[model samples]
Target: MIKNAIYLLFSFFIIGCVSTKSTLKNVDYKATKPKIEKGKYVITEYANDPKYGYNKEYPINIGFANLHSEEYFVKLFFNGLTNPEGDIFSYEKIETCCPFPSNHNKMGVGLLHKYRVTFNNGTTKDLYINLYEKGEILCPNGFKILAN
Candidate 1:
């Protein structure tokens, strides 16, 4: 009796997790800012202005190479992001989506997308490298937020 009830509860739990599907659409970003050479984009002097606070001046590029299709990648590059003071901070999540290349195969090359953010203390961070197809990124990696 108890065992049967536990099994039923476990099955419902698994079903709840499986019901959620990814709701992401492909994007064709317009060049609102100047393009960088060598396939990189630069965000210069972002801290100097308030509008670009979340995204500081940095360089980024998107292209195909040394990666596999259907595989999304998320990498974070930073200097002194962690501090002893532990001043907890939060930033809005950024989303980027790339379409699957036509030449994609089980073993195909990958595309790269760079999002660079520079700090006021001369620290720089790069997020979302080769994040093609679709990927999820949470900044200050491994930090989970509690829901209100």
Candidate 2:
């Protein structure tokens, strides 16, 4: 119980430090959710900008509002991608960083979830995800959209 309390307090303290303005560059409130098939998101476009998802300022904004779990959306998003050579990929959330203001959360702030994606060929890259806002779902550079 003490550990849980300490964690909660630490979380509050971190959230309290968020800036009043968000720095995310890709949040689109009018963006529509991607279609899901075979437990994966159906992504058709590749991000033209190299910084998309790979930079903290341009996280892949998969909003949590219409979903039950933010992690579920993260999985679906990754599941729809593969290496350029069509090799399957695996990913894990390695860290949460880059707090920013967002009205979507009860704390009025949100943090970016950084994921480490590993391809079958032993290559890895870090991608940042934002759960507090919506944006176009696209395959990042160095990756391809899984065929439907």
Candidate 3:
């Protein structure tokens, strides 16, 4: 009986201290649109709640001129975006403004930046990038939005 009680206690302790990383495989995906600002692609279709501390990264806009490229999913069923030929810009790469973070961070929103993109075709273009603010998505490229 003592051994059984100890096992139960150990199980409870282990369970309490465990942290989990989530995978999106079981998540339901919905097709959504994106915005193109100064030759940069912005996925504004994502719905993030700031109340839950989900607004960690501020929007950083990276840009290049006359950018033309093909974008595809990094994996067959993954959450990353990549380009094999053209230029690729993602919302994940944004936000490098402020250092201090709190429940509210000024880093959550900031100014835009420009970048020069050299594509696989050896062509050069100027690009501009910015965060996709709520109700700020002007163009939609059919990006994917996952829902529970």
- Model 1: weakest 10-residue lDDT segment is 70-79
lDDT of 1 by residue, 1-148 (tens): 9999998786555444432332222222332332233322232222232222132121122222235421221221121133223333222224432322322223222233444444335454444443323212122332222211
Comparing 2 and 3 by lDDT, which wins?
2
**lDDT per prediction?**
0.31, 0.88, 0.29
Off by over 4 Å in 2: 1-8, 65-68
- Count clashing pairs, candidate 2: 0
Q: Best-fitting candidate, measured by lDDT?
A: 2
Between candidates 2 and 3, the one scoring higher on TM-score is: 2
Q: What is the C-alpha RMSD of each candidate to the true structure, in Å?
A: 13.9, 2.1, 16.2
Residue 6, candidate 3: C-alpha displacement in angstroms: 58
Query: What is the overall TM-score of model 1 with all chains considered together?
Result: 0.23
- Over 1-148, each residue of candidate 2 has an lDDT whose tens digit, in order, gives 9999998998788777877778999999999889999999999888999999999999998886533586788888988988999988888989988989888887788888899998888889999999888899889999988898
Which structure among the candidates has the greatest TM-score?
2
* lDDT of each residue in 80-103, candidate 3, tens digit only: 223343234333222322222111
Displacement of the residue 114 alpha carbon in candidate 2, Å: 0.5
